[model samples]
Target chain A: LAKTTQPISMDSYEGQEVNITCSHNNIATNDYITWYQQFPSQGPRFIIQGYKTKVTNEVASLFIPADRKSSTLSLPRVSLSDTAVYYCLVDYNQGGKLIFGQGTELSVKP
Target chain B: EPEVTQTPSHQVTQMGQEVILRCVPISNHLYFYWYRQILGQKVEFLVSFYNNEISEKSEIFDDQFSVERPDGSNFTLKIRSTKLEDSAMYFCASSDEGSRNDEQFFGPGTRLTVL
Candidate 1:
């Protein structure tokens, strides 16, 4: 499993774009970068996933550089409800075990 | 969109007592998992069940913890003897299959408190 490192917390204003970056220097070739959003007292929800380059979905966008050592989750036009803990997970297919790091707590303030 | 559902949103039990957490995964899904998150901590995997058997499990799942698909629709996690440290929120998730890109849908969770 690739260990991921991210900020403990971040603050952003409503309508502002938020980008949370995760570093996985030991990412394997078969590993895929995935992001999950978790609100207080709720299970983590899948937001976006990508193997390389950019992949956009209705909720968020994932950008992975060529090296695949790092990836960024971009949330456009954030709202107060968007305040949640965001986790960047690597290798979701390895025995279906997702090792979670200390996630980035995004506080979207009004 | 279909969602996974768990019963007894909250459970309170005494130490050394037994407790069972129940979940009903999406009708068409085939993979089931159990995860727990202690207060002020990250989510940790407990076990994964597929085809009515366990495919994988983490160290957190010990002899005291067991999972079973007792029926066609119900998936259960039984703790033989509860401990104070076992208090946490247990989440149930299910995926369509074992494919790489399959997204796992999660239930709200069952908060277990052992006194």
Candidate 2:
């Protein structure tokens, strides 16, 4: 599994755009960038995933540069409920020995 | 929508006692995983089970830990002897495919407290 680095915390207001970036300098060709959201007392929820370029879903958008060494998770029109920890994981498409670093605690203030 | 389910929302146990955490993965999921989070810490993966066998495990999964699929619908994690350090939230997750490219659904988690 490739290691990842991300901010420990970020703050944003409701209706604003929140973008949390992750740096994985040692990413492999088969490694896919995946993001998960975890609220207090709940398990991590899958938000969006992408290998490269741009991928958008109802919850977030993932942007990957041509290098694939870095990716950003962009949340559009944030709400108070979006307050949670966001984790960025880099793993092989075949999946094994997945590791999670301390996620970015996102606080959406009113 | 299918979801993973775990029993005993919270469990309090004495040191040296055994504890079993049960989980019901999404009905169609073929890959099952167990993870734990210490208070204010990162989510750590313990083990991954596929086809009734363990496909991978972390160093955190010591000899005292074991996993079993007792029935077709249930996956379980057994801690032979609980320790004070074992206090954490245990989460059960599952994915329809055994690949990391697939999305894994997680349960609410079982809070285990060892005193």
> What's each prediction's TM-score?
0.97, 0.97
Error of 1 at B49 (Å): 0.5
Q: Candidate 1 residues B30-106, lDDT tens each?
A: 99999999999999989999998999999999999999999899999999999999999999999988665667888
Per-residue lDDT of candidate 2, residues B3-73 (tens digit): 89998999999999999999999988889999999989999999999999999888899999999999989
Expressed as tens digits, the lDDT of each residue in A1-56 for candidate 1 is: 44899999999999999999999998878888889999999999999999999999
Residue-wise C-alpha lDDT for candidate 2, range A1-110, written one tens digit per residue? 44899999999999999999999999988889999999999999999999999999888999999999999999999999999999999955346545789989999999
Please tell me how candidate 2 rates in CAPRI terms. Answer: medium
Model 2 clash tally? Answer: 0
Backbone clash total, candidate 1: 0
Superposed on all Cα atoms, the candidates' RMSDs to the truth, in angstroms, are 1.1, 1.4
> What is the Cα-based lDDT of residue B77 in candidate 1?
97
